[model samples]
Target: MAAFSPELTVIYATIRTLDDQHPQATAVLVGGGRVLAVGSREEMAALAPRAHVLDHRDLILTPGLAEAHIHLVAYGFSLAELNLHGARSVSEVQARVAQRTMNTPPGTWLRGGGFLLSELGLDEYPAAAVLDEVSPHHPVLLFSRDLHLGWANSLALRLAGIRPDTPDPVGGRIVRPLGTLLESASELVTRVMPVPSEADFLAAAKAGVEDLAGRGYVSAHTMAFEEPEAPRALQTLAARGDLPLRIWACLPHERLEQARELGLACSPGSLFQWGGVKFFADGALGSRTAWLHGPGFAGGSGTGMPLDSPDLIRERGAEALRLGLTPVTHAIGDRANTEVLEVYEALRPLADEKGIRLRIEHAQHLRPEDIPRFRGLTASVQPIHLQADGPMIRELLPHRVDTSYAFRSLKAAGAVLAFGSDAPVAPPEYRANFAAALTRRDDEGQPIAPAEALTEEEILWAHTRGPALAAGWEDEGIIRPGARAAFTLWDRIGGNARALVL
Candidate 1:
């Protein structure tokens, strides 16, 4: 037996179906939670005489939006933690931790993230003693918003057994004299902490989903880092018919074999599907670990860190393609992007052979010459980060500023631009992304790249079809008659819209 919609429900008035054939169609028929038919209002009504009708007299109807990248569990965890994204100085950060500690138990771990080194106004990493002053009894661990670095007080460092003599861990650094941990180094302290229980995972997952929905997202690509129980929690919600948004999950590379054993393949559909094999190619911009090219940041001492070797990426990428998984890797700086692109170039034939699309997350900063090479690849980018990164770009890579976030250049090169928030890294606010994409203005009101600014229609396309293509979601992200009925209704672009669950 199949489901039929409540008879006679026709949505009318100024419908924009995002269909090439009927670009400005004015009506859509809904049944069984899918777009049954789309035509002129008179044509649709005659087909179902007694159908209920919705008049969207003043709204723009478009396909439901999708977030191309985010860490769902981390975003949920951040909701309850102290945020330090804009701490102007070490004192400001201490003030926040002090306030948080006051309300926390005497010996409880003070857990929070979202600090930026540049915002801290420190030339060097702050000393742990600064944090120990207010959080003497409690163990305090504050992670950089990018999650690539961690700032910890003396107590927290001691608890994690990190000392001046502690050598740098493989592929990570413990900032000396006792204060910060970089990349894999942060894992030491994190691993020692108590793991959140199943109940915690469920709560965080629920909150994260609700937050996304509130921000007008109809779906998301959750890059896995959460515990095994996390995806199960989402499955539970979906199975009980409680999920309001669709999820496309990417398991960490470590679990690739397990996923393959379970018969998981890229673009495998079940409403919610396993979309890709996620991997980290390098660290983040904030932590100065973003792998950079030869003339690395004007005054910076190092040229950033190389996370996963190119050989490793190539090997894993090939394996993922063989198993029908999209290879999505995080690459930030020019060097990182360049190296990963090289890996992709090598894997392109195989990817094409397997009918897979190669996805590069955070194609943030790129060497102009390399932009064209991204043609036909998925540039899963975050426009919202530009707001915060604009100033950094000026100070760090001034010469390349024009080419950074080169949306226009990349698009012209034939690359698919899939915009996203990289949530938890920044808040998952689609409105912010829209504003940033259209305006190209930094927090200081400076234009990072005026020429790269996209129009409302282009941004909408990137948010919808770009991601759809990246994920290989054929039936979604369009408003044609044969498309799924999922859509959002807004009076205008960049505003909160009511998601009509068809």
Candidate 2:
């Protein structure tokens, strides 16, 4: 019998295969799901006469996209819950929940997320009674748009064992007259919920990863928020050789010791790796907790919550570097970014010595002068965030309009711009990222700061090469012979297409 060789698949088209040497390979030879070679259609066909061929003549093929930052498990859960992301007022939120309750069984949890206090047009926290009126029997748990704060109904408060006397946790706050929990305080309620079994965890992780792959994502950086088992669940998938895409996970700062004891360092493996140490510097803009300098927002009374001291961040960040882990901090506001940049500057020499780069997540808003300091750092930002935040940004940070989501300027200042959708906070919508980054327009169709908008090519680079560089994976982002075989097909940017990867 003739030697049985691996079957080949030749993808043909006006190809945009992102291949170097031949950046526009009209045909690709794929074997065992990896691109075996790229050449002219005649050349590829001659080499693999028995190959099965796929003709995507109308599509553009590019490197598989990467979401530089996201919270995967949380996004999976949010997909099953009520979405109040764009509710324009508190009444809108209440009405939606009330309608949802009418269909839901009486005692079931009325779980929901994605309410923005700014979008709700509320000057202060909503009274817990407001949720009580509509959800008297059900325990209502609503996460703020940023996921930093949670608003609960009376039933949920009781369920969480929280009371007026329930003192705030060290790194969180329990609002007075009882309804809201910030930061660590949100965990009080979350901790009471039943832990999902291994099956549930696998199901969620699977759904989330599949959804991303469908959206042209070949890789993601999962920001840790859940228990240690969550990352373990992801590891199980990779270990079993069942994982379809690359996953880089972070360990919360508190778990640093645990990670150390396991002798885990960044870049531990290819499929699943412990890549970064995550820290929260301040809250979110939607919840009005984004730390800022001087007057917080134009008309808002508060300047936003001050969070983990810079000194602490610097100290812990250095330790993470020593352990060969990338230190990534979430900083939403100018003040938050300012402080984090300061911490990074203090530890720059060490980071350089250790060959680790510091990343600042959601560097959404910036002070004019501080923008340049992001130079040589990874600004892991979410362009999809602008769609939901455009209007509110106009109201809150009107004075800093030109500087908010300053993509062009950040790039100009020499920052590596990695774009992502902080799913659960905002769904992982690459089309939306393309639209928002290129247009800088809000949902209302008004330009937030037109000058800040990026070109289509620029947006693509940020979502592709910028993210790969940030993750320290040079070979994966570009389409080269030795690069990992991952590619996304596109009919057009901001349009539908399929993803193909090995």
Candidate 3:
């Protein structure tokens, strides 16, 4: 164990240890940043007479929450960016962009996201003219809520040299009218945008960590949807002992070789560690890019786009496992999930040999046959997304509606369900996740998959223990002797919660 404060602290509360041997406790003795004992208040007091006592007899204490997936630095920077999450129309989006533009200089770039095309009541891809009308002098780029589609104004398109005839890049597409860039095409504008300084990256990393910590999370698994500097900033924080949340980070598969060259393996023990390699098998549903099976989207929206090939995932995944890293893939559509499962099937033997769990992010839509295939895999899902995606699934994917966001089914299939917010795409609000999972209701108050609803205890486990297991952190996500001392105090399960700062 690493050095920690020598002083002993005993916390008295209604403790849910989540341990079979000692399922309940009234007091916990903590030292060296770990649990030393768990029992009744009198027993703990007798064991550590000189320990400082924290009385919280009315509150419920459980293992600390973990955000199973997030784009940490991007979410931090988004705190200051324009937000269009609830915008219901083109006019509303225009007004928000115009408001931000009026407060900024003419040539500056304005960036933000969180709008759904379906919610905006748009039948086709939105044109650049919609935003150009609001901020003609300034460049603007807004992403779809799923981050799979980019809505760029004429100025921003011109800056990226995207014209009407520009060819779509592999694994991405550029919509007509030169307004929307899908998948890898979004990189066109983003690559040309001004890069943040080292200080800016560090600050954003700090903000994201602090925000989650404040929300009662003791840890997070940051997905690799950010610049390389993002993780570097987090590492700097870890080195300086400024990070409050333990972070398990992923590198884009493109960096796998470089990681191998640097001799980087799964090095745990510190507050921050690299543990997974992230890959996208397909785009997102809201963007109409989910790689679906035959008969695809109901209205001829066609089967979704596939990003990484199965061959690449298989070959590279084997290499990643050899280095002690998990192979994490993003699979949203049934076809995407099917294909990824095929790849994982090939990698399973190697993964088992290495003792690493293969993870699938957003196993949102699935075929009944594929449900059984998820056994022993980590289904890192976001129930909060169900609130917004419910109607979309009904409209575009009616055939798969029964299995969409199938949390209960996934759990019953022996898949470890790790809940998360996919922050920046959505806020990292655990309450939203709890409500969405328990209710199975969408924004329209319609049930997407009522049979998929999970209980509050199950949701709690997904948020805490499930994520810890996915990240291979055996000492976290449970309140027991020899476990991390971090925990969350709740007024009630599925109610207000705050981290117990020890």
Ranking by lDDT: 3, 1, 2
Which ten-residue region of model 3 has the weakest summed lDDT? Answer: 1-10
List runs of model 1 lying over 4 Å from the truth: 1-8
Kindly list the per-residue Cα lDDT of model 2 for residues 211-300, writing each as its tens digit: 888787899999997777678778888888877788888989888887778887886446898889998889888777888887888785
Cα lDDT for residue 78, candidate 2: 72
lDDT of 2 at 502: 55
Q: List per-prediction Cα lDDT, in the order shown.
A: 0.83, 0.83, 0.94
Which predicted model would earn the best TM-score?
A: 3
Evaluated at residue 183, the lDDT of candidate 3 is 98
Ranking by TM-score: 3, 1, 2
lDDT of 3: 0.94
Count of clashing pairs, candidate 2: 0
- Please give, for residues 143-245, the per-residue lDDT of candidate 3 as tens digits: 9999999999999999999999999988889999789999999999999999999999999999999999999999999999899999999999999989999
**Candidate 1 vs 2: which has more TM-score:** 1
Per-residue accuracy of model 1 over 446-482 as CA lDDT, tens digit each? 9998999998888888887788888887777888766
- Which number leads on lDDT? 3
Clashing pairs in 2: none
